[model samples]
Target: MKKFVSLACVFTMAVSVLAGCGSAKTETKAETTGETVAESTAAAGGKLIMATEAGFAPYEYTEDGQTVIGVDVDIANEIAKAMGKELEIQNMTFDGALLAVQEGAVDFAAAGISVIPERQENMDFSIEYATSKQVIVVKKGADVITSPEDIKEGTAVGVQMGTTADFYCGDLGCDVKQYNKYAEAALELMNGKIACIVMDSLPAEQLVAANEELEILDAELFTDKYAIAVKKGNTELLDQINEVLQTLVDEGKVDEYTINHTTK
Candidate 1:
């Protein structure tokens, strides 16, 4: 009888030990899962939707069967990651891009958007990531439009709508033809629909490199300061974006993108 009691007590102690170990494992697993959930939640706060034309090469354009990729795309991706969000780039017209950000239809617009006083009134802009001059692209050895001064009255100048080029050409007293995409305008220039294409210098170079017949004119029209734009008064998001952009600028990430992604 005493021996039976001793064995029963031993079995009870073994059972207790097993139960304690099982409880500990369960608690540990639960804790690990909870930590993973928290980390996931912190890493993702939905997608940060960005509006871009994706027609401006070296800034943003389609490649690899409609995959939007460029310098601005890369920069925007980094900014989104810094903010702990996924990036969703919405390709559209340049004018439409600005309107989308202005109307809060997207988080921000980052398609090499130039920061001008007019844009400043409608939307807040992040720090300038790039500076490019408005340049004239024309056929090789073109005699009529040799310089900025030659782009006077009656010159059929093509420009992307809502761009510094458009604004500058309008001021030039030339016949300004506005297109949604700079690529279209470039095509127009190639087909002789327009005398010249006024665009940012970097993208003009890209176009020139792709088409053997095209060349950028010697004169640069104006300087364009590229930046990301958010709706006015959205200070919180603007601040976050600026913080990330400054970090990138300080670390020379912007220059890296310009050097590597620039096709020309």
Candidate 2:
């Protein structure tokens, strides 16, 4: 009986030791996981995912069928480099770009986005990088439909959906046909599907110059300032982008890019 009791006690001691060992293993794993989470959060700093509508020429667009190149892309890259972070460009529609930043799907957006009070209510904006006026594009040598009033009552104006041009057309009571992309609208204008295409003057000029079949009216439409946009309340990121933008402007880098890319 004494020998049996001693053996049972030995067995109990072994089980307790194994259980304690298992607990220590679990605690170590938990500590490791906690530390990993903390490190991941810290390393995410300034590593930005930037979204843009890649169809907007001179601002953001694809080149050589593979490379995404534009003023916005260049500026964003410079900003990321200055911030000591990585930049990932997500090609998306203008509305999608805005939504991505708002939902934390992207860190920010730079799509030749115009800054307006309505948009400011939902998203933050960096310092304006470019200024543009709205313009109408039509077939070259066609009677210049220079002004909104010149558009015939039944004429249709093509515009990118969710853009300021769309809103401007609606406000002017002009008939509008919305396209998913700027290139689509430009194509429709080329095909005479729409009487005119309303867009930012700089891009419209670039497109018209390239196509040779289209021309822009001399009259100006609404003027607006374009800026990088971020999610509302993202003051840290907003301030950083603004600082970078101002530096570019002050150092004449912005002018250099404009001169290099502009069609003389």
Candidate 3:
């Protein structure tokens, strides 16, 4: 009887040990799952994704190799830092950047984008950060286009696609040529493929500074306000961006940024 009782006690102890092992394994698995979820959330929540065309200098352009650095890049970095997130810049075409924001593929876009009614209909814009004018660029010593009025019918005009210049180039009664990069349009102008290039005054200045043979016409076609774009109905992000932009403006940082990045 004693032996039988001892065997029963051993059986009970063995069952308890097995149950303890099972419970430990389950707990470990649960802990690992919890950690994974937390890590995933942190990764997703701590990044600020921005889309931009890196060809627009003094705004966002490649520098020192493949790194994109410019006024807009600096401003976006500051905003992301203020939001306690890391900035991730995605280089894409100007149209693609806008589309990425519209499709929720990115948090925002800042590529010297001008605020216009058509863009406003698709995405919300932050407060204006900088004011820019659309100007005509032509080869120096070219007597064909002395002023904005010279862009008459059949004159070949080059402009970066998806810019305000592209939007208004048709009004000049010229055969508009569109390029993905402002630099490319500037090149086409240099090659005499286009009689003139229409672009924002800032980038036009940068281009002309690099290509001394190129010059900006004395008159500007029109002025536009530059702003950042967020997805439609994303008032939260819009507000955040505006807050940061206003801070930058109030502190005179925007002007400083322009001055620092602009070419003489």
Candidate 4:
């Protein structure tokens, strides 16, 4: 697993021809300056709902095509456990997951979501839990794209819509096809429909591992931070989510769960 890029890299953050996305469907203003406006709430012995696009693993991906599970799922479960609630996962598109969280349609979202300024306007994020390099994946023996610079307008690229990879790839000014799931983009890659795919590194590892014809580029497109997205003013839930996440981070469990999922 040398430099497999881990949650920092492991998920190239995606892979697989087998795709499963269930249907879907906020706000507490989160402080950006490392501060939390704590609030009081009653005991949580109910359902703690979370939205996610179950296509990015070891962060999130389905094994049975119906049951969504991964590092993000584990974290969400921990949040539920902390609140003394049951975890309910809603699997959907990456964009849909974020939107659901923003509209308060769900309690939160854990889609390996990157904390960009634009997103911050609509949703408050828990403290950054993981950092990832947006990576590029290409077919085996595709010598033309030896480096990021080689990817120009003529280079047709595929990406999961609304991901940091999608933004980074768009900046490259390449011809890009936006898919709801990286799984679909991977299908396109395997079919030789695109020159490459862009995504988080770790899931990219999973993708490449599953599809031998795919290979990750040594270069990175950009780096991003992953966090849980909640409504703008949901301080109670955001604080709880952050507390659980902080515990996981401090205990070194986040990286451990990430490694375990990737290795599995």
lDDT of 4 by residue, 141-223 (tens): 86757788877776799988998777776776888899997778888987888888888899999988988888998999778
lDDT of 4 at 255: 93
Q: After superposition, how far is residue 74 of candidate 2 from its true place, in Å?
A: 1.4
lDDT of 1 by residue, 133-231 (tens): 888899776665888888887889998899887887787788999999766887787788899988988888888887888898778878888999999
lDDT of each: 0.85, 0.80, 0.86, 0.83
lDDT of 3 by residue, 1-264 (tens): 999999999999999999999998787666557444334324447888999998887899876657888999889988887777789999999999999999999999999999888999999999888988888899988777888777777888898889888878776577989999877887888888999998888888888888888999889999988899999999867777888889999999999999988853
Each model's total of backbone clashes: 0, 0, 0, 34
Candidate 1 has its poorest 10 consecutive residues by lDDT at 35-44
- Give the clashing residue pairs of candidate 2, or none: none
Per-residue error at 250 for model 4, in Å?
0.6
Error of 4 at 160 (Å): 0.3
**Model 4 residue 68 lDDT score:** 90
- Candidate 1 local lDDT, residue 193: 86
Q: Give the candidates in order of lDDT, highest first.
A: 3, 1, 4, 2
Looking at model 4, residue 47 earns an lDDT score of: 81
